[model samples]
Target: MATATRRSSRLSSLAESISSSAGSTQTPNSRKRKQSPVATPSTPPQKRQRPAKLPAATPTPSAVGLMAHATSATKKPTNPMVARLADPQTTNATLLSPETSRVITHMNVAAIPSRLPQPSTTTATLLEEANAHLIKVDERMRPLVENNFCRVFSPEGLAEAIDPFESLASGIISQQVSGAAAKSIKAKFVALFEGDRRFPHPSDVAPLPIERLRTAGLSQRKAEYIKGLAEKFVSGELSAQMLNDARYEEVLRHLIAVRGLGKWSVEMFACFGLKRMDVFSLGDLGVQRGMAAFVGKDVAKLKNKGGKWKYMSEKEMLELSEKFAPYRSLFMWYMWRVEETDISTME
Candidate 1:
């Protein structure tokens, strides 16, 4: 009985211990203790960041040069619509949305030299004047005018009136001859001078034998013209300075006064030799044909002969050329570039 009582006391003590352990435990639904979050100093939420913008892409000078040469190698764009579409300025304005244009304008504002004030007044003035004239011509012939003719119209030393006697002589030699043949003949003509170099005067030409001039490939008629031109020059009846000072009419008269110079020759001299800015030549078959082609007209009928054809008449040429006044010489230059189609080439 004593052992039993001791065992029962042990059991009671064990039960009390179990109850104290149960009282210390928490239920799953109870809230967790809020230990102050280990004080990592809070950083203010970063303002929403934006991506960096790229700088405008302007072509380098060398890159632009390469692009220009490559562009030139391709055949010129012929369609007016295509030409307009190819231009960045026109394309952007015509095709892009307003917001896109604004973005492009902002990006390219620094790269565009057109927006910058120009310092060279002379070039700008000349180009502005030429463009004003060309804009009128473009209205009539958009396709031809839009395709590049700047090089054709650009001022070149080919038309400088440095020496009237030499210039006219060169023109005479070049008449009805291929450029290569004319060059060879001119060299021979100059060689004759070194052999007959006694006097440095145009009168000196009088003493040169007709046979000697013919040896340089001049036909009998051309020989006579050269001698007569020299005589006029020696007499001081014609001078480069005088021609430079004279009006177009006076210059034409003075050149015609020479025995061999015809209207075509005189026109060539005025337009190419004297650099007359406004002269136009109706007699130039090339110009007539070019104008006809550009105007989209048949230049000639096959049955015609002796210069009578459906080709643009001299009166029409003059009237049509009026639109390019003051820059007609440049217009004439570009005419030579027009291709001679089968119809245009017919007699």
Candidate 2:
């Protein structure tokens, strides 16, 4: 009986060992356990492979340089929406909306300058170049600028004509709209004109039926305003060169004297059309906004209280532009761009 009991105990131990071995070798009974990638969540997931990495972003280049290259390089924009879109690398760059893509492709990204003063370049060397560029942006832009204003200009020459026309146009559109809304609408306008106009000549523009101009996304009044200017140019009432030939103040005075021409409008014509350095139209909201932005504030109530902008009087805006000197027009242009436009302009 004692021998029989020992053999039974030994058999029980052997059975227990066999059961443990079978359980360790076998798969789980559940279907999920059998098929799941990892039986349970023990680690974070790895990202799926992407097709490719995006091109590394470049340091902001000068808008003037970009425009000089882009405008001269192609008759039509490669991507028209890029100018009005937000920066691709910015936190806010990730966005949704039908117009978002359009904004990134249709606008003139070259309109604004991106570079600033760097050790490799100097104020004097860039001054001459900026001065010359200023002359081309607008005639009145010349008056608000100075011949000797090379100091501020060259170091910050890229600021000279950054966003030249688009910025002015943005200011025109942004009177009461949010920056995003203004950009969306502005993209439509740029897409319509730059794409469809095919560099409409002054005469071609003058007689464009109001409907045709409107189709290009301009409001009736704006269309008329542009047409009226065109007609004036075609007729002897106004000559575009008159602004070029006249002194800076004379240019401003003459431009502002036009019935529809205001300080802001004249400033744009000067900054963009003429490429004047050191221009700041106090009447412009974008200038005000840019001023606030430069000072690092979001519409501070004490704007006037701070002496920084105040010290830059109407004349000083020109003089301070001189500190930026010949690059004033570029500065005005880029700052204007910052108000409502972006580098994503498609072309």
Candidate 3:
């Protein structure tokens, strides 16, 4: 009985110790549970409500309204060409603004530099090679040649007519005028020299009065241009020998110095007058029109404004013409022919 009583008492003590320890551990956890319910209800609801308001604040606007706002906030164009067109000098300003014209003119000069490879093919060899190349690149040229409708031939008489002065005078006379009118003016100009000369020698012309030159249907500006060209010849700044001997670019440097002889004018003189095989002019209207027609697209539909067609950019035109290097002048002549007889009919 004594042993059994001792065992029962020890068991009762162990149960009491376990029950106390359990109560101690439960006390802090019960307190935390009470606080968390209140805190979570306040903070959790506030966080959810803030996010809901953010989505509501972002109102979706129409595309047109957004575009209008963007346009109004934007600055005006800084490009000189665009600015000139938008606010032209005169109300009756044509499609090409003066500033745009100047920019394009300079752009052509820079893009298509007056440089070409030395003419390697002789007059005898030029025909065969040029014809072969042309036929290979454009088969349309073959039928015309075969039918005798056109002939691709090299220009003659370069060495005999190396007089830069007379050539520059011709260029000045041809400016902004029709070919027939330019020829008429040139005839009148040649007649002024007297002695039944084919054209006025620089020595005879350099001494003539500006008014005397005006009789040749030349504007006062054109008269001045011719007189200046004559003076250069007389002063030996421009010599026929230099023109004959100089490289293509050197010739350009001397000729371009004369006020009225632009790059296009010099190129024409080089290609046709001097019979240079490699000369080209990206700025020439005939060349541009011919290229557009050759490509089977009307230039009038390209980058048009105010019912006028803008010329192709110099880089684009030069890129097209680059394949004909060292014999481009012949190709240019052919292009002019293509323009005259529509390219579509050639095939």
Regions more than 4 Å wrong, model 3: 1-120, 137-152, 155-164, 176-188, 194-196, 215-217, 296-303, 306-313, 341-347
lDDT pick, better of 1 and 2:
1
What residue pairs clash in candidate 1, if any at all? none
Candidate 2 residue runs with Cα over 4 Å from true position: 1-197, 258-260, 284-347
Candidate 2 positional error at 252, Å: 1.6
Local lDDT at 36 for model 1: 45
Q: RMSD, each candidate, Å?
A: 39.1, 25.7, 36.1
lDDT of 1 by residue, 1-347 (tens): 12222222232233333434446463222334544444446865445433242221111111111111111111232221211111111111111111111111112222437777643322113333555566676665444556644432222221111345555666566655544676687677767767542212466566788888899899887788888888776676775445645577887888888876666556655654444557776755556667777678753332234624335767888887888877776677566546321111100
TM-score for each of the candidates:
0.54, 0.38, 0.53
Greater TM-score among 1 and 3 belongs to: 1
Ranking by TM-score: 1, 3, 2
User: TM-score: which is higher, 1 or 2?
Assistant: 1
Taking the tens digit of each residue's C-alpha lDDT, what string does model 3 give over 175-254? Answer: 55644676688789888867744455567787889999999899999899888887887787876555544677887888
User: What are the clash counts of all predictions, listed in order?
Assistant: 0, 54, 0
